[model samples]
Target chain A: MKLIMNLMASILLSVPAFIASVHAETAVIVSLDNKNTYTSIDKELVARIFLAKVTKFPDGTTAKPVNLKQGHYLREGFNRDFLSKTESQLSRYWSRLRFSGKASLPKEVNTVEEMKLAVANDQSLIGYIDAMDVDDTIKVVHKY
Target chain B: MRIGSIIGSVLAAVLVTTTVQANSGDLNIYGFMSVGVGILDKNEVTIEDFEGEGNFKQDTVLGIQVSKQVNDNTTATGQLVSRGSSDFKTEAAWAFISYQTSTDLTARMGRLRIPFFYYSEFLEVGYAYNWVRLPSDVYNIPFSSFDGVDFTQRFSIGSLDNSIQVNYGRLNDELTIFDENYQSDLKNMAGISLTSTYGDWGFRIAGQRTEMTLDTEVDEAYVSAVQVATIAQMTHSANPTPQSGVDLQAAASALAEAEVVFVEQRRIDQGQTGAILLAQQMNLDLEVQDEFAFDGHVADFYNAAITFDNGNYSFIGEVTAIEYESGLLVDNRAWLASFAKRWGDTTTHLTYSTSRDVLNSGDSGKLQEALNLQGEDKSVTLGLRYDYDVNTALKVEAQYHDEIMNRGVEGDYAMLYSFAVDVIF
Candidate 1:
């Protein structure tokens, strides 16, 4: 009975860790300001923007994509939306693109506050933040 | 001619307009430029009467690329590249469209890269790769564009990080230079590659298949003229050296070797038909005003490449093969291995790499072919790179080339090097 209980406990402990890594990437929806007029962003377009593959938004407003420096929730959200690539993966990808003249690397801003401020200030700016970080100033386009 | 001029004018207009668009709202524009000086430390080798060492400033390049995003998921990219002296002339290096699927996968279509090896996609990005230049022998095929679709997917497998990519495409190109002629076609290319990582180490393995038809015509007279002209230039370039005359003689001899072989092949094609020989020679003479005229080259080509990487270090190698229908042997292979060590937070790295190409024996129709192969050629390079940040950086590189004469084309060894800086606006 004790062994069975221990086995159950161990299995339960491992599941979340496995699940977290496998699902570390999240799908996010983003927009210009807190208007919340559009609630969903196309999954593919999100990928294109983060990879610097896309230049326009759904409504063709010329979406300005902002990156949350290196270690912010919004940046992670953005990565998940566009490439699911981490900083290193991004580095390698850019290395290839830089050589071919396909695209340049994205702009980096270190803090979520900086991210929020930048996105809020620009009419075309789009950024990804955690669901909890969303406020009246930044509208939620999609959430994972 | 008028249509060509009109098209050229339109292209120029569009480029001017795009440059004006630079960065507006969702639009972002960025690119890079570089220039450098090179020298040959050694010239005039005399082991087997070789005379092509010690030339410099023959290795300079410049490039510019622009990209725009159409929507959240779809994007378009166009790149124009140039190398060698004179402000980087136009080289149709890269032009394509790409799409991303979620965060884990992306796809691209249009004039895509051949993806023959790990560096195939970035062969010209001397700033990105370690080598001063890829081995000319291994990457000898003159073509790198294709109409195809490429798909890349990234995900995890157990404790490993994995990415797999597959590409399919077709390509065709033609060339005409004096009397040497080449025509080619590559149809239906399908290839798959995979990259996996465990800890700081990563690895790649991939392969591809190609089918092609190639047609070629060579002008003996034009080739002879070009050889003589090139010899004259080399002699002028080598004037300061005492062995210049000897080098000239050796070059002339090599030309003779090629001539003897070419004429033999021509005679075979002529066979017993004197009328055929006279008619073909007349046509060839008209077609080849200078150098050698290129005939139509049609063929299907395929390639595969694999790579391995460790955070502070990496190595990538690839091999590409193609069969030509134009009775000429067009098979070649090249590989590059690199190792790098990085400094601290500032991001400085030093690396060394080498590339080589080996030519395979070709098929000769009825005509006795010299198979003018010396053996293989290789380029060894050492370089240093510094990245102040992702968008800005600098690189320096040097290379030494060793040549082998195949059946009979003059082969000369050279030493070349360069330094470059990259920036964004």
Candidate 2:
């Protein structure tokens, strides 16, 4: 009975830690060509860019923002941490802007691989992905 | 023949340009649709032709938008919407061409939304807002669109972001009041708005002014009174006798009696001359027309709003005031407060809204009654929204509306329940 009680306590303690590790660290990324022009970006600016409030990069070039498809875990993590908005909140925000003709929602890619490919192909493009997925083709501009 | 062929060639060229650009991935198509079923517990509250029992078509709508990038600096966009309130008639909601002058400035021209309220631009897009609908007391403006030019400028100061918009426009449309339609025109409509945001807080202030003209059916009593007054003046001018003065006073008193006679005569014979003779004897103005016209009227509106959001909790409050210089339109003040809490995929909100019209003792009885009817509505709404999918939400709401006044008299209250689905693609 003592051994079983001790085992149950350990399992219960590890459950929360395991769940916390399930949420991946998110990174805001740009094409390799934009690495020199945009080495690092502040969180505020990243939020604004993703929200379509700011449309241009620091170098004065038009910023094309891309996003992972809805329901993607990394995308939700990025929205929560960097944008400080939930998926539903962002959806409502984008709907308002999109319908009003004030701004357009970011283009969506189905997977991280597709997002990286899209960003790599366009110098002005910006997107976010799991930190583990960052490689040579894209530059990490911000991480959360 | 040459001119016709040249015009045809120009048309073909334009068509080709549109087709090629659309195929080049420079064009985007988007749309939203919302449908709802609502039931009023009692027939106490009425909106236009919708009242009594249950209604399925009152809140149904669909909108389609297309945008084309003409170049790096220019883009064209248009939206078409069909609403159940208009009997599912499709109309152009927006048709504008925007030019990006710089990173922080843009200019646009064409038919655009008149931003009288914070949600004016997306008012029809039900998926955008939290409520089942925006408070009708405040959002119920006669005109929603204008042909205009506008400039928008955006900037940031430290952690605060700001945007300013200025516009000038004109609108010519029909406005409906009490189930009667009037020809309405607004000229030289100009407005400015400023919005600021910092983290989870947002604030906005906007003001607008316009010169207005309206035409409506003349009241029978008013027409008769004016006719009698005119005839009295003519008789007095033609003959300066004491007997003529007495006759004029009698005619003025008989103006009310002449209404039945006028109606009877019109029914018997549409163009009988006997009625004119009777009206003339009563000192009526034979040249009176059937329509009442009001021109050179001025109207002004101002509004302010503040919002705060911290992911799990959100709150918004707004106030608006409208005034007419000529007293042709009722002056009104309205306010709304809303609070919401989000838990996972569900959000629950409560809202309170009220409106009152400022009545002037100096106004005519008829005008005062109309203004009173316009002034008094208060409502409390409870709503829940569930994100059923990535791009869809299911919402249910119940509103209790208390009518403070109806037709210059105290009125009763009502309750409404509604269920809706809002989707975007």
Listed per prediction, chain B TM-scores read 0.61, 0.79
Top model number, lDDT: 2
DockQ values per model: 0.16, 0.50
Q: Mind giving the per-residue lDDT tens digits that candidate 2 earns over B1-425? A: 99999999999999999898767987899999999888888775674234878798988999999998899889899999999977898888899999987667989899898888788888888888777667887888867888999999988776688889999999898765554566778999999999888888999999989987766323455356657766786888898689779878777767756555555432112112222334445454433121112465678999999999888899999999998664334578999999999999899999999988775343232343433334588899999999887679899999888878755578678788888899988
User: Weakest 10 consecutive residues, lDDT, candidate 1 chain B?
Assistant: B285-294
Clashes of each: 51, 3
- Per-residue CA lDDT of model 1 for B263-316, tens digit only, reads 654421222122223334343322111111113334434444445543444555
Per-candidate TM vs. native? 0.56, 0.80
DockQ of 2: 0.50
Model 2 / residue B212 / CA error / Å = 1.0
